[model samples]
Target: MASRDLVTGKIFSLQTIVGILGNFSVLYFYLFLHYTRCKLRSTDCNLKNLTVANLLVIFSKGVPKMMAGFGLKDFINDFGCKFFFYVHRVGRDVSIGTTCLLSVFQAIAISPLNSRWAELKVKAHKYIATSNIFCWILNMMLNIILPLYVTDKRNNTNFTQKTDYGYCYVMEDGTVTMKIYAALILCRDGFSLVLIVSASSFTVFILHRHKQQVRYIHRNNLSPRSSPESTATQSILVLLCTFVSLWTLSSIFLICLTVLNNLSLWLRNTSALINACFPTVSPYILINYDSRVPRVCFA
Candidate 1:
């Protein structure tokens, strides 16, 4: 128990600090770089959207759990619990949606100069901006129902029949109804997953074709023009792959947590931490790839 608690505390501390610094660095770069240029790329706007969602996630999920690790578990009220999970769900959904938008936008932006998508690339900024707004509105509405089912453990301590997860309480009014809600949430997430896979597939296909063309041109001239678009696309690909892997692993662990009987507190907390790990991991990917961030740290 001591070792588990020690590990959990250290991990939580690491995640919170890394997430704050990394996401904040991304935000700062966008501010300075975009403001100085007095222009924003479509990808930059989408990156800002993603960074903001991740910051929301870190604040909502990471901070509370960090506090929990430090033995401040009773600080949250019922409303706090509901609000935490609500924000957590919204941030996660928005992150997925923004990633899909980024992939789709990049695929459009990097289309062949003569292709139909090239025309859309000229107007990519408007499309990306509109999509970010739509993602925020859509995710907010999709997760609004979350608070109804989640509450603080204080409320549950009075009820002997309640199910508590150390930090929060789930008041299961009806098993069937909860199952239906879970299915709906899963379906929503599944739809987002499909969008990401489709967009990523399209991006990959376009990049492959572009690379072949570049190779042919380079063979002729013995010089290749590297594309800013391709470099950015590579970064997005890393972000997409990392997010999907973390989300998938977290989902698998979640499924097991539900199916297994009398799960240990360490297992339960670790699974929840895994779900929060993506935000911490993703910001660093963006920062490492982005040119605007100072090069000295990476060096």
Candidate 2:
């Protein structure tokens, strides 16, 4: 019942509610598009998966943090802690995985027909579904160990309960096995980061060239109404930039929180808050990105 917890709780509670509403609203748009279309486009397919990934993030991480904020400090037990962290890690990892996929797929979608990437577009549909399944498998396998390390902090005297957010981390064993496992996890995330950046960069490169081509044809007199491709590219660029900025900030702070033992609690909450904002904002971006979709569909 500390004053700080009360304040933090209220703020995160508001964040969680906003996240749910925003993501679900986007979900509705996707669902409507799915049933109405004769066939689903690769972008829509990737986005549908992204919607699920973001929702998983909200349900997995946001809800627990919100509960903890509402003074449910000890509401969770050992099993509950295990379940919460398990789902949270899986959801967190999957969100990043899906983002990487979305970036790559969109990049491929916009690639020139003669380009090597465009050749893969034919298989993009199948590749996306298969990749989605692979992503889920990889995330679940990698993060299943998270719950093993997490337990109810109240019952354990040896490990310090983290006060930054809802979950507690098990004390590091310092054994070679634990060290290797840590490295492996870092490598997984590192690869995901590299993919995200590379994909975003390539997308922007292609889009820039595309814009130049259009400019040459129109003599720099572009139409007020944007083409679907143009709108999609702009949307992807904004989404990728926003995602990378937030992801980098959260990753840096979370690593610091884990490595530095003397950091204050406020910093930890700040990191969690950053992590929570991405899911909420991303859905709105997706919904508003294309003026053609919902308006045309509902009309």
Candidate 3:
């Protein structure tokens, strides 16, 4: 049993490290380019926000998993446990919020000229950063109360249990704390999911419309190849779609586990891995699909 646990931990730790390092590298390139020559356009700002959110996810969730793998769970004392979990929960929410915002911004950017939100494009860059900052502060404030509801138990006494597993919530006899915590998590996740779905759907609809228009223009010989902006927009659409799909699947799994209450440890851990893997894979796609990279490299 010990050997099995050790192997599992090692695998997860390595996976987390790879994901974190990959995201950091991609963020560095994007930031450096943006500062040197690339102006802070709406698109660039959105991407930067996404990268920052990814960094938080890596630190809060990925690093803890890595530490747990190395049997450093004890390093997280009572205070450490509460703070770590707090950050982990809040960081994940922020990531979801930022991604949803990115999708909405991108959709609005590509909306028809006469659409209701079309005017937003002109002034969006000015306020997008402010909005992102608000999101971070809002989420942090909301999650500040989490530690009050959580604590570390030394052993399985009544409602508290210390099994081979690392950190967990042990339901005390007749205490509604665990249920309350679960409900809060559900509410937060559900709210973010709704936003993600709405934004992703809107972006997909606009992308399809734009693609059709591009095809029509090509058929009439009005244009030969897609415009550079169009190409970049399409790439972002793909990335957003991929992110939405992966997160949706993982969210579904989480909902089932939380509600049905029959998931095994393997299934739970697998879901965590899936959630982490999306941000890990996103950076690679961003770098490879970025059209300006070649220009920047050559310049």
Q: What digit string (tens of lDDT, one per residue) describes model 1 on residues 190-289?
A: 8878877887888899888868767767777865645655667888989988988898998898888767756788887878788778888888898777
Task: Residues 123-233, candidate 2: write the lDDT tens digits.
Answer: 787888889889989989877666666667576556443433455545555668667778887888788789889988888898788777677657657665778777877
State the TM-score for model 1: 0.88
- In angstroms, give how far residue 54 of model 2 lies from its true place: 1.6
What's the CA error at residue 94 for candidate 1, in Å? 1.0
- The alpha-carbon deviation from the true structure for residue 99 of candidate 3, after best TM-score superposition, in angstroms, is 0.8
TM-score of 3: 0.83
lDDT of 3: 0.69
- Show where candidate 2 strays beyond 4 Å: 160-169, 220-222, 296-299
**lDDT, candidate 3, 1-299, per-residue tens:** 36655766787777777767777866777767867876544777767777777766667666666666566655565676677667776767777777777777777777787888868876766778898888889888777766665555443345342222255442323347656656776787677667767766777788787677677677777747666667777677778778778888988877766555435666766776777777677777777777776766576
In terms of TM-score, the best-performing candidate is: 2
Stretches of candidate 3 exceeding 4 Å from the true structure: 153-188, 216-224, 260-264, 295-299
Error of 2 at 130 (Å): 0.9
Question: Which model, 2 or 3, shows the larger lDDT?
Answer: 2
Model 1, 111: alpha-carbon shift in Å?
2.2
